[model samples]
Target: MGISVTNISKSYKNAKALQDISFEVKPNELFGIIGPDGAGKTTLFRILTTLLFPDQGTATVAGFDVVKDYKKIRNSVGYMPGKFSLYHDLTVEENLNFFATIFGTTIEENYNLIKDIYIQIEPFKDRRAGKLSGGMKQKLALSCALIHKPKVLFLDEPTTGVDPVSRKEFWEMLKRLQQKGITILVSTPYMDEAALCDRVALIQDGKILQIDTPEAIVKHYPTSLYNVRSTNMYQLITSLKTYEHHHSVYPFGEFVHYTDTRSDFNPEDLKVYLESKTLSDIQIERTEATIEDSFMELST
Candidate 1:
């Protein structure tokens, strides 16, 4: 079943936590909420999963109202919070069993649903949840979240603080889960991870900046982009920004991304411009727009 959120918003004392956010997730689609901390991702997830109600607008999960039909929404969605909130002292198996029992189900009943992910950590099932590594703890938490076999899974920053390998593995497992026809809505602060989703909504300061497929967002990046590297990267940034034609300059990996004021400016022009500014060992090249680049452009 699909999820739909329409103009949903929430607030704290003096600050708005979410501002007129709206989006839709198709059945079995892997949709992502991409943003940095304090972007209202957690607040939106909480509202959608029926943990909290929005001050404005409405949302439905599998055709159940978030507020009035909270029970149905709660039962239909599996939520993995940003923090690892399972019983720390409970063993992996115990945690899984606990969650299953809460839903009036057994781990074995849903074993096939999570078998691929659970088996990886099954050998350490007897280990205390607190004693497990970050990645293993994540896996165990996910296993518990899925023990009930909900139709929609909401993962809130599930890969945060884990190692790169574990993060990659977690995403792979999510793809496998998606193949089972379960809808997934995940929130992430990592730009690169945005590409993994079928569609993403980039948010900032409690507001939606843009929403589109990763490729569409990147393709919409404005201006001619170039990556310039030099021996003195810091000085190069300063000098480039001071140049008359320099439009915008920011650090991008080992190089600085820059745009020129004039549409006529080309690679050879950039080389001459840098050389005139006394920059040495300069390497300038046009570069493709990445999710991060699109985000930076939109955020500004």
Candidate 2:
């Protein structure tokens, strides 16, 4: 088994963090938990990693119970928290050695497992982890997480603060790791990254909105989506929202993604209405649904 969560619930005093959430990751699969900040991604990760206990329900990681077999689960999973948690005063190499030693192993014993990720940071081995750049710190953290060659990896928002180039590189590294038969559970707030996973769970407000392959989720979008744009973007949004038949309108990059409540909706009808509002240079056309589109629909 890879990972299993059944009716897991957690709360923090007056607030509910995760409410009866359930999901599973198949062995060797690249699973993604996609959500916005405060969607309880970190809380769920902590529970699965055995750092925190769920208020209700149960979870297992790598064939070990999170509560009963916590020790076994800890040994079988590599966890990289969202924030950099390594010793700031320690040099990169020293930090790696410390983690390896904690797991009753040596860096040389698992050198091949982290070779691809470590080499990039090898030149900075002598530098303090806190002094390394954001990207370098990310590599160092991942190297330490994999120091013992755990069967499963849990990366919580691993690319949140990194530059775009580094984010891309990190995902590529994950792809290679998946090919090595290590089941990966990654959480991210970036909707664009959802497509890269084999499957994704879209969560919001402490609830699961949907779960499926990104492509399948897009294919099942409930309404016909259109991309609408004009010279006055602000006025266009205001006017679109005020329209009588409009179902939903959200700003997406350069265009507004719109859905109509009527089944017989026509672009020309919308174009005419927009022109009535003195919105000039209006462009309306059918557009393919994206993961972001599906998320917006589900979350609403």
Candidate 3:
């Protein structure tokens, strides 16, 4: 087994951080948990990594019970947290060696597993960890996590705060690791990143809305969507929400993704309506739904 979570729940004082959450990550599969901040992604990661105890439910990682076999699970998995937790005072090589030593393994013992990532930072091995660029820091953290060749890897928002080019490169590294039979579980708030995973779970306010392949999730969008834009972006949004036939209106990049309340709605009629409201240069075209669109529909 890779990971199994059943009815997991947690609370902090009066607030419930996670509410009866449950999901499975198949062995060797890249599973993603997609949600924004305060959605309980970190709480769930901490519980699975054996760093925190849940108030309810049960979980297992790498076929070992999270509560009963915490020690075994910690040894069998590698975790790269959302923030950089490595020693800033230590040199790159020094930090790497420290982590490896903790797991009773030397870098040379598992050089093959982290060679792809380590090679990129090896040139700066003499430099202090705090002096490295954001991308470099990310690579070093990942390298340290993989030093012991864990069977399961848990990356919490690995690409968050990095450049787009670096983000792309990071995902490529994860795919190569998956090829070597390491089960991966990653969490991200970016909808685009969700598509790269084999499957995803959309969560909001401590509850799971839906879980499926990205393609299947978008296909399940219940209504026809359209891209709407006009001279005034703010007014266009305001006017659409007040329209008699409007169903859902959300700002997606430069265009407003809108759905109609009527099944036989016409774009031309909407354009005419906008014109009557003093909005000009109105453009409305049918567009396909995205993961974000499906999430908005479910959360609403």
lDDT of each: 0.92, 0.95, 0.95
RMSD per candidate (Å) reads 1.4, 0.8, 0.8
lDDT of 3 by residue, 66-161 (tens): 899999998999999999999999999999999999999999999999999999999999999999999999999999999999999999999899
- For 144-195, candidate 2 gives per-residue lDDT tens digits of 9999999999999999989999999999999999998899999999999999
Q: Which regions in candidate 3 have their CA more than 4 angstroms from the true location? A: none
Query: In model 1, which residue pairs have backbone atoms overlapping below 3 Å?
Result: none
- Clashing pairs for model 2 are none
Distance (Å) between predicted and true CA of 35, model 1? 0.9
Model 3 TM-score (2 dp): 0.98
lDDT of candidate 1 over 1-300, digit per residue (tens): 999999998999889999999889999999999999999999999999888889999999988999999998888889999999999889999999999999999999999999999999999989999999999999998998899998999999999999999999999999999999899999999999999999999999889999899999999988889999999898899988888888788998898998878888877877888788888988988889899888888887
